[model samples]
Structure formats: structure tokens, C-alpha cells
Target: MLIGEVARRSGVSARMLRHYESLGLVVPSGRTVGGYREYAETDIQRIFHVESLRTLGLSLRQIGQVLDDPGFAPSALIGDLIRETERRLAREQELLKRLRAVDASGPTAWEGVLRITELLRGLGSPSAARRQQAVLAAEADVPAPVLAEAALAEADPHVAGALRWALARAGEDVVAALAPGLESPDADVRRRAVQVLADLPGDEAAEALTSALADLDPQVRAHAAIALGARGSAEAVPVLVAMIIDGVNDVDAAEVLGALASDPGRADAIKRALTAELADPAAPGPARLRLVQALAELPGPIALPMLRALVSDEDRTVARTAAALAGVIETQDGV
Candidate 1:
């Protein structure tokens, strides 16, 4: 076949076929009387092969090595191609996300678009200070979704706090954006997400925390319970009691439970829960100690009976700790 027929059948443009010939990638196997390039069947097949490799994201140089070098191994080259394709895909996906965030912001001008883009970059910056700055400048029109995403992924304490603050100020709509992070496989992400939800004021955030109370991660459930208890969600009573028993952030848990117990009904429930845990013979000594200490934070009328009973308990350490706490509770009552 002549080069024209070869180009037509193979879908390779004649100019590209000529370029391939110049690069010695697929030279014509013969020539006509007019001295035009002519291609044999093998030459046309090689053109098809080059096009096939290009679709796999192979560069022209890599294709040349693959087709021309008999000693070339494809395994390493194929791995490199996969990695390059993945990197390109990641970049494209990130760009698409940024564009969507900008569109979600309803930016009306090029400058608004640019500012949103820059703020997103700052939020994702490696520097904690930069991330904090981005969150602080969020009042300048950063979208809530962007702040929510950054807040969920952020590990730095100060930056995470700022991001939560910004998201809360952005609006309650961010609750929807943040709700998914509660189910994240990463426990740290789930914990951070619950913390942000805690700071956000609304029934939406409260509902999210109430749902998170059953999360598989103990830390996540503990954080959720504390947040819920502070908001007067009595559903947290059981988890708060458990936190005291497990000695996980038990202090904060006790404090929040104390606040929740200000209600007469919740106080009665909290008092019973604490005494029930104490009644379990299998409850470990350290747990008993932690429980005794937590009861001190409860109202005097409810805790005094338990403290009085525990002061003469079987365990000496428990007895001493309970005695000391009872004295403190009684002295405070006297005042």
C-alpha cells in the first residue's frame, strides 16, 4: 500500500506517518516510480502498534524504545506509565474539586475565583500557620464545604480549632458536609470530625453527635458523648458513665456529666449509673478509684450516700480514696 492508503486504513495521519518515518519508527518498506513513500503490510502494522501504545499514555520516546529496542523490558516502563497516569488523574480530580468549590461559592468575578482558589491552597498548605490563616480569612468569602473538608483532615490542634471556628461561622449548612466524616475509617478523622461538630451550634450538629455516640472507635464515642452531654443530651449519660469506668478522658467526661446532671431527672439517673458501676464486683480497682473520684463531681445529696458507703469498702486503696473524697464533699457541703 502507498503511504496515503496506509494512513487512511490505519487512522494515522499522513503527517504523523511521515514524522514516524523521520524518527525511523516506521519507515516505508518501498517506493513508487514517482519516488513517493510506499508501505508494506508490516510497516502499516507497526503504525497501528504505535497508536496502541500512545493510548496507554506512552510518550513518543518511550514508544520508540518499546518498538525499536529488542532488549527493552516493558515491566518497568509499564509501571512508570501507570504511575504517570495515576498522577495525572489525581491532578485532574483535584482541579475538578477546586472548580466545584469555586462554583459552589457562586463567585461572580475572576478575582473571586482566584481568591477562593488561593484560600483552598492555603487550607491545604503544609504549614499549620498558613492553614490557620486561611480559616481566619474565611470570613472574606471562603465556602463552607472547603472549610469542612480541611477541618476534617487537619491534624494540627490549633489549625483544626480555627477551621472548626470558621466552619461554624460559615453557617449550619456545613453540618451536611461534615456529617460524612463521622463514618471515616480513620479514627483520627472521625475524632476531629466529632470535635468540629461539637463546636457547631444547631440541632443538626447535635443530631450528628447523637448518632456518633455508637461509633466503633472508643475515642470517637467518648468525644461525641462529652459533646452531647454538654449540650444537655441525656443520651450521653451511659457513655459518660462508661468513660469514667474505662478511664478515657474520664475527667472531662465527669465534668460534662455533672453539667448534664443539673436537671433533677438526669441527676437521679447519673447517680444510679455511678452506684451501679460501683456495685459490680468484677470492676477493677483502678476503675473503682476513677469512679469514686467522678462521683465527687456530682451533687452532694446524690453522692454523699455512695461516698459514705465506699469509705469503709473492702479495698484499702478504695477506702482511702473514697474517705478522702468523702471528707472533701462533706466539708464543701458544710460551707
Candidate 2:
């Protein structure tokens, strides 16, 4: 088969296929005397394995070694894959738990909390709750946030309250381990702080969250906007609105802000964020899109003009979002 056929069969782009070749993961089985690359059925099948290994979370270098793994039998290879998958899943679980438990800097425990947390790490990722009763007993040895995270999935309000009370006396060392997860190294630590700050209650969290606004991650800035919506601060609206208008991830950021803007006080903040960009000449179509959506959610004569302007905008995508907004308004008004 030709290179194109290999790409078609493997669902890997031709450019990436060339990259794989450079990485030495695959080589054409033969070449024509005239110099055309020729591949065999075996080579195409090998490409699928490469794709599979990449999907399994192995880095290219790691994948290369996995392909070259020796002493390990087939069963051993499967076990390794399962272990890796579990590790990722555990990280996600930890992130979600932290999201639920974070309160703010106040009175929290440090020593006992660390002891309790080892129990969690011992849970081997997703089996996090397998040792529940023992964990709850040692819970006082953990951080309040970690304790709260551990109990987030439960429904009983009384149980939840009890957990919160326990969180009050959690140890400091445990607090250190209660960090959030992020894919980017720089974004990771800051995002973790942001998650904890936003979830934690009171003035300390507010101060921390304000500082987190300078985070380089657009996604984090957008999330900060949504978190502000819950707390209903006039100060955060402009930044969130600005992000909705011009941030690269405006679509997601706009959606979060819109959801949080239901409170009357937040309306003006979001409107302020949107109105400036509603008429911005240099901003991209998506900026206009999120702004229009935000304006539609607020619903006022101010937005109607922007919506009208959008109907005739140069960008088809912006015009489309505006048209949709107009339709939503018409539906609401019984037009």
C-alpha cells in the first residue's frame, strides 16, 4: 500500500504518519526501484498499534519502549496498561474530591490530616472509598478540605455536616496534600490554588481568588468568571465579560458566565463585560458570539441594538450567533 492508504487505514494524518516514521515506530516494508515508498499489510496493522498505544496515555518514547518490551508476557503488558489507566483515573478522582471539599483559609488541621490522607492514596485510585469506616475514624488526622472531599459523594445532610465539623480541626500537613490537578505544569499549581480558593468560603478565599485572576490559563480565567457569578461580585463581571468577548476559549467561558448571571446584581457586570466588544472592530467572530449570547441572557434594549448590528456583521459566524440570539428573544416575547 502507499503512504496515503496507510493514513486512511490508520486514521492518523499523513503529516503525523511521517512524524511516526521519523520516530522509528514504523517503516515502509519496501521501496520501488523508482524510489516510491511501499508498505505491506503488516506495516498498516502496526500503525493501528501505534495509535492504540498513544491512546493508552503512553508518551511516544514510552510507547516505543512498550512496543519493545521484552521479558514481559502479553498478560503483563495488559496489567501495565490497567495500572496506568487507574493512575489517571485516580488523579481525576482526587481533583473532583478537592473541588467538593475546599472551604477557605480558617481553622484547619495539619498533622492527623496527613495520616488520614495516606489511607486515601492507599485506595489505589478509584477504590478510594473501599476503606471508609477506618478512614472516617482517622479523619481528624486529615485536613478539613480532604475530609470534606472524601465525603462529597454522600447524600445525608447530617453526615455532610458532621464531616464539615471534622474539617474545622483538620491538620496543616494534610492541607498541603489537598492540591488540585492541572495538565499544564505552571497552570497546575495555580489552578489547584484557584480551585481551593473558589470552593472555600469567606474573605480569605476571596482574596486568593482575586490573585488567581492573573492566571495565564484562559480556561482558568474563564472559570474564575463563573465562580464569581456564584458569589455575585460586581468587580469580577467586567473581566469575565472581557473573556467572553475576546478570550480564546470564549465559547466555554461565555457559557459559564451566562449560567452564573441569573442573579439580578450580576446582570450589569456581565452587560458591562459584553457591550464594549459588541461593537469592537478588531475582535474575532467568537468574541462577538459570546458577547451576544451574554447579552441575550440579560435581555434589554441595549442588547437589541448589538443583536441587530450582529445580523449584518462581516463574519458569517458572528452573524449566525446574533441571528440565534434574535430568535431566542423573539421566542421569549411571543413574536
Candidate 3:
């Protein structure tokens, strides 16, 4: 076949086939008597091979080596191609995300687009200070969803705080944006989501936190419980009680419970929960002692009876502490 027929059948342009010949990658098998290049079946096959390698992101030079060097082990080259492809894909995805974010900002002009782009660049900067400045300088311009995403991925404590603060001001849209982070497979991401949600005002944020209360991570659960309790949701009661028993942030848990007990019905429930723990013989000494201290946070009248009963308890430390607390309550109550 002539070069034209080969180019037509193989889908390789004639110019590219000539370029390949120039590089000595694929030379036509023969020449016509009139001097035009001619190609044999084997030469066309080599042309197809070069094109196949190009699809795998191989440079022309690498393809030359691959086609010429029979001893070349492709494993290392293939691995390198995979890594490079992954990096290129990551960059493309990031660029797409930035474009979407900029579009979401509803920029009306090129300047607005540039501003949003610069802000996004700062948010993604490696320096924590730059990330923080991006958030602090955002004002009402940067969209809430962007801030929420940055908040979830931010590793620096200070920058994370700034992101959360920005999200807090970004309004209810932030709640929806943060929803996916709550379901993230990464525990740290979920924890950060809960932390940001804790500061977000509104029932939606509270509802998101309610879902987080069931999170498998103890810290995630604890943060959710505290946030819920502060929101006056009784849903946090069980976790708060558990915190006391486990001695994990027991003091804060007790204080929130005490505040919750301002409601008469909730007060009764709180009293019963504490008494039940105290009655459990299997309860550890430290846990029981912590429980005793927690009870002291309750209203004087409500805590006094439990405190009085515990005064002569089996554990001397418990007895002395209870005795001291009860006496103080009695003196304060003028009983």
C-alpha cells in the first residue's frame, strides 16, 4: 500500500506519518519507482502501535524507547504513568471545583471572578496564615458552602476556627454544605463537621448535630451531645449521663445536665438517673465519685437528699466529700 492508503485506513494523518518517519519511529517499508513513500503491512502495524502507546500518556521519546528496547520492563513505566495520570486528574478536579465555586458566587464580571478565584487560592494555600486571612477577609462575599468545605478540610486549629466563624456568618446554606462531611468516611472530617455545626445557629444545625450524636467516634458523639444540650434538646441526656460514668468531660456534661434540670420534669429524671448509677454495685470507685460530684451540680433541694444519703456511704472519700457538700447545701438552705 502507498502512504496515502495507509494513512486513510489506519486513521493516522499523513503529516503525522511523515513526522513519525522523520523521528525514525516508523519508516515506510519501500518507495515507489516515482519516489513517493510506500508502506507495507508491517509498517502500518508499527504506526498503530505508536498511536496506542500515546493514549497511555507516553511521550514520543518514551514511545520510541518502548518500541525499540525489547529489554525495557514496562512495570516501572506503567506505574509512573499511573501516578502522573492521578496527579493530572487531581488538578483537573480541583480546577473544576474552583470553577463551580466561582459560579456559585454569582460573579457578574471578570473582576468578581478574579476576586473569588484569588480567595479560593488563599483558602487552599499551604500556609495556615494565608488560609486564615482568606476566611477573615471574606466578609459576606465568599459563599457559605465554600467556607464549610474549607472548614471540614482545614487541619490547622486556628484556620479551622476562622473557617467555622466564616461559615457561621454565611447562614443556613452552610448546614446543607456541611451535611456530606458528617457522613465522611474519615473520622477527623466528621469530627470537624460536628465542631462547625456546633457553632452554627438554627434548627437545621441542631438537627444535623442530632444525627451526629449517633456517630461511632466518642469525641464526635460528645461534641454533638454538648451542642444539643446547649440548644435545650433533651436528646443529649443519655450521652451526657454516659460521659459522667465514663469520666470523659464529665464536668462539662454535669454542668449541662444541671442546666437542663431547671425544668421540673427533667430535674426528676436527672435525679433518678444519678441515683440509679449510685445504686449500681459494679460502678467503679472513680466513676461513682465523679457521679457524686455531678449530683452536686443539681439544684440544692434536689441534690440535698442524695448528698445526705451519700454522707455515710461505703467509700470514705465518697462519704467525706458528700458530707462536706451536704453540709454546705444545708448551710445555704438554712436547714
Candidate with the greatest lDDT versus the true structure: 3
Tens digits of per-residue lDDT for model 3, 14-52: 999999999999998899999999998889889999999
**Residues forming the 10-long window of minimal summed lDDT in candidate 2:** 174-183
Off by over 4 Å in 2: 1-141, 144-185, 246-252, 259-266, 300-302
| Best candidate, TM-score | 3
Report lDDT (CA) for all predictions. Answer: 0.87, 0.61, 0.90
Q: What is the TM-score of each candidate against the true structure?
A: 0.93, 0.47, 0.94
37 Cα displacement, candidate 3 (Å): 2.6
- Poorest lDDT segment (10 consecutive residues) of candidate 3: 138-147
Total clashes for model 2: 13
lDDT for each residue of candidate 2 in 1-335, tens digit (9 for 90 to 100): 87887778778888887888899888788988888778898888788887887786667876777676765365666677799889989989876754344323322566434554455554324443443443555544444555544444333444444444454456343333334322236664455445544555665556556655666787666566566656766556666776766655566555556665566666566665566666668877666666767667554444566687778777888788888888778777766
Taking every candidate in turn, the Cα RMSD to the unseen true structure, in Å, is 1.9, 19.6, 1.7
Write the number of the candidate with greater lDDT, choosing between 2 and 3: 3
